[model samples]
Target: MVCRVSGILLAVASAAAVGGCGGEGGPTSPPPPGPPPPPPGPTIGASLNLRPGEVHVLSERDAIRAFEIQGAAEGREYQVIVMSASLSEGRTTPLRVRARADDVSPNVVPNARTNRSGRDAAIPPARGLAGELRPDRDWHLRQMIETERELRRLRARPAEGIGRASRGLAAAVSDVPRVGDTLTVRSAIVPGGGVQCTANTPIKSTVRTVGEHFIIVEDDRLAGRFTEEDYADLDRELDEFIAPVSHEYFGEPDDLDGNQRVIAFFTGEVNRLSEPESGSVVIGFHWIGNLFERENCPASNEAEIVWLIGPDPDAEFGIEIGVDFVKRVARSLVAHEYQHLLNASQRLGGQRGQDTWGNADLWINEGLSHVAEEVTGFYRQGLRVRGNYGYTELIAGDPDLVAFRDFFEGNLENAREYLSATTEFNPLALNNNTLDFATRGWGYVFVRWFGDRYGPAGPGGIVAGSGEAALYRELAVGGPGYLFGYENFLRAAEVVAGETTTWGDVLAEHFAASAADDAHEALPDGAQFSTWNWPRLWEELRTAGVRGLTGGDPLRRRIIQMGAGVSSTDEFDLGSSTARYYHLRAAGGHPSMIVETTIASGGNVPNSAEARIIVVRTR
Candidate 1:
């Protein structure tokens, strides 16, 4: 008898099936209701109408596509030149493509780079500086990148463990470190001038607040001067927010020393590493050696550890870490380094991408760290800049706003820099450790933009796992759904925006959204950030120059001045993961302009430096 049957006599019910698939012969229980029949797929013939510069991706491969290049007016002028391009790694065979005039057009206007335009104009780093990290700003990333390579290179030798303390070996991994336990750590000279993360420098740590997720350790002597609550605040932020946020988005950390928690070694030693007059501030950093087995890598503690500069008001060392973390600088670095730890840990545990270090691509990794900082900012105190305010009022008052500005300014400011010179920076270049503000900010913008679309985007681009855990987890651990690196990015984007999304689509639209103007308005649809009006915010920040960081400018003023259809064109070298923008408008009285696109060459557009234009018409 099925349980669904109305009340039955106890005797019969006992003899028959009670509930789901009961034992003994019984009326065949219906196979557990199969999953609701798959949703009906979309109807067949899909049509897309693109405007003068609007883009539509041809879904089918090696299949012909149709375009009716219609013009309502006789003088409707538009440049429609399509050249075959590939974001793929290899060269393309000579394929059939039809574009007008094989050579540069006489009417074509020579477009210089945004940075190259003027002095007030933002200058891009020279071509040689293409993929380099910012000078002295990121010692941690530089050190770790080389450290991983050196360790792997050294791994070819047989039986290479730094050895155990039980055997009286050097820098051995100890048993689970407990509160109040002091441990000797093998560290390195701060990477200002000398060798980086060499493990020769030694620092003593006294375990302070050992939380469930983080073991807060302080430098033995001076660091203990900070109140226990001060130390515990670091642990609390990591436990309640930072660590969990990182673990959610980038996966968990490694427990190489059987601690099952991250050792956040806060010391003044790190802060003092900064050379005087250089103005470089070294924040928290998780040494990559901690991930390696001590037996394999001599410098390794074989445990997860992030070293941070501690509070020193006098600047006896260099930069002050500041005591009140919840109110100041240290809080941000906690989230920053924590993300690095999780990302590296995730890749170390079988999710490695194309980088030589077997970690996630640097742009992706750095971007996440930057986003991690801002998201933590939102989570910690909530974003203070909710709407566009006049530059004068915003700077003049609001203490909470000022604290928020100081804390949440780096990524925001860097992204503004990225916007000023979007054409030069390649968001996907992984060839070297050229991890500057532009590249790093590009990643941050990508993640923020993607999360705004796919993830549970809340106010100001904060993607919270509270609503949906899937996107966060999928991002952290590369799966069959999203392999890794650039491939991972493309597929995951398809999951939200539809599978028709491609590198070209991403480049074109991203260029539009980030341009901070009606350029996005002129593009297809859904090109700008779903939340956050960047143009207004940047405009406010720029008008108030007081918000600018010491070395960096607040934001560059937009240099280009545009007018109605003057009939002009420009050539571009569209490299892999880079894009450029063009404006095509109808003549002063004409109704509209139509652009037809196609590729005509044995073209390898990835590095082809070929000419392509994406028109952003002014309304």
Candidate 2:
């Protein structure tokens, strides 16, 4: 009986299933058909003006994309990403946009319809669904969108809109790295009042307050190393050197604290404080590491000057390193380092606090520092001006014969030495020993020559021009056509000459002349060379007719164009045997030549001496 009932129930269930297929009473009748195909995908009758909306979404296909659909208006940039998309098959949503995201830019097409005639409509708006959304990495897309929108709002004039947008973005993202930041290293001592690091390595230390602008952390055990009077005098000398002198040259105050204080660490390990292989007895050195940038370190604007004392054999006894000698050396070191600080801090190519030694030829920076020693009178202290073995003293003797002869010879020798170095470094390149022979020796001579030949307004014009009164304007960049090279210096020389002149021509002419030439002879059957001191040679050149002397042939009038590459000759009668002046201008951009008559006859007679004037281009 149970088996018969089971068969009947099965038959009845199969019949009901068949009826349900054709009946409206079925439990799963097709989902009440989702609201009429979303009104034929809402016609894009007007321009698809999108406006700002709360909901944003990011969808990536080929490239990342971010946008908002609701209320998206024309000419308005949107930052929000799209959260949902209501796209349809056989129908296209007109995505009119000039969009850029990462490396992808898609062009917008106008009048693109969601469907063709008689084709299926777009998916319903209510059917919009969310897909992968990445708002974090969408800034690039937003930036492009903003940039484009701003451009469009300005009537597609990209010059104004795009430029401003780009600058804004750059400014927002750019940051000054801490690559050369400096901290105030106040005087400190470790626990147990241990020794401070100095030339005297193991001496107990006491951080002594050495007044404003400096602190002397001295070795307590070597209290007698330097006297209180010595410190005071040294301090006074330093102040004098920096104020109204070094400060005037750089056109800025010393790079010091508001109180003008600096720290001085006197130690026994002279070699430890100085550069490697810098000899065993180092007088002093400035820490260049504090000026240059390190891999992950910031540099300091001011350099801490270190002095090696009582350790160097020469510095210990009052022999070659007498008290006066020590004082002079210390002051000179201060001046040298201060100039370096100026170079590193002064503006170069629109950049400030840059390493000038790295940017400019090392010879220039080092030469400038060496020149600073004389210009600031650090080398003159404790001795007569002429007694010091400085640039000024080196220029002693007649300005015409001895001084200029010495100058040229020095320049040639130093140049040859530098070029012949086995290291194969360019003469203009900077290095550890750059200042030793060439820079400090010949380089200083050139600097002095520039200053003396041009007066305060000439090539050495840098001295007066680069003063605090001038606001320390960068003469090298904006003030004039000055560059950091010998060629540029020649340009300044011409400017000082008040006519088109080239130093190259002058130098070449000198090189061709015999050492014993009568033209440059001071006395003994020669013209009166300028009576001015050698330090004032530029002033004399400014006033004199001829800039240089050539061959001893006194009869042949040699017209030397310091910066020319051609040659010519002319003959004229000396209407009077007495001196007659003539200004000769020639081709090849040669300077306006100033010629004074040289006659074989001594009397004032219009003699047909057939005076011949030869013009030569030196360079």
Alpha-carbon deviation at 314 in model 1, angstroms? 4.5
* Residue-wise C-alpha lDDT for candidate 2, range 1-619, written one tens digit per residue: 0001011111222223222354665555443423332221111111112221211111222111112111211222222111111111111111111111212212211222121111112211110001111111111112223332332333221111112222211122222212122223312112322112111123334544354445454544335556777777766765655434555554343232222344454544332322233222244444433322211112222223333343333533221223443444565556655665555434322232232223343445545555566555422232222121323333444344332221232232233233222122233433333234434433444343344333233222323322122222232221343355555455555544443554333322221121112222222211111111331332233344222211111111222221222222222222111111111222333221111121222121111321222111111
User: What tens digits encode model 1's per-residue C-alpha lDDT throughout 487-535?
Assistant: 6666665653355565566555555555433234554444556435665
Off by over 4 Å in 2: 1-223, 253-265, 269-280, 292-295, 298-325, 348-350, 353-359, 378-426, 429-435, 457-483, 487-619
- lDDT of candidate 2 vs native? 0.30
- Stretches of candidate 1 above 4 Å error? 1-135, 156-178, 190-198, 313-327, 351-360, 382-398, 428-433, 456-469, 480-482, 494-500, 516-525, 543-546, 549-573, 582-612, 616-618
Per-model TM-score, in order, reads 0.68, 0.39
Residue 385 displacement in candidate 1 (angstroms): 14
The worst-scoring run of ten residues by lDDT in candidate 2 lies at 126-135
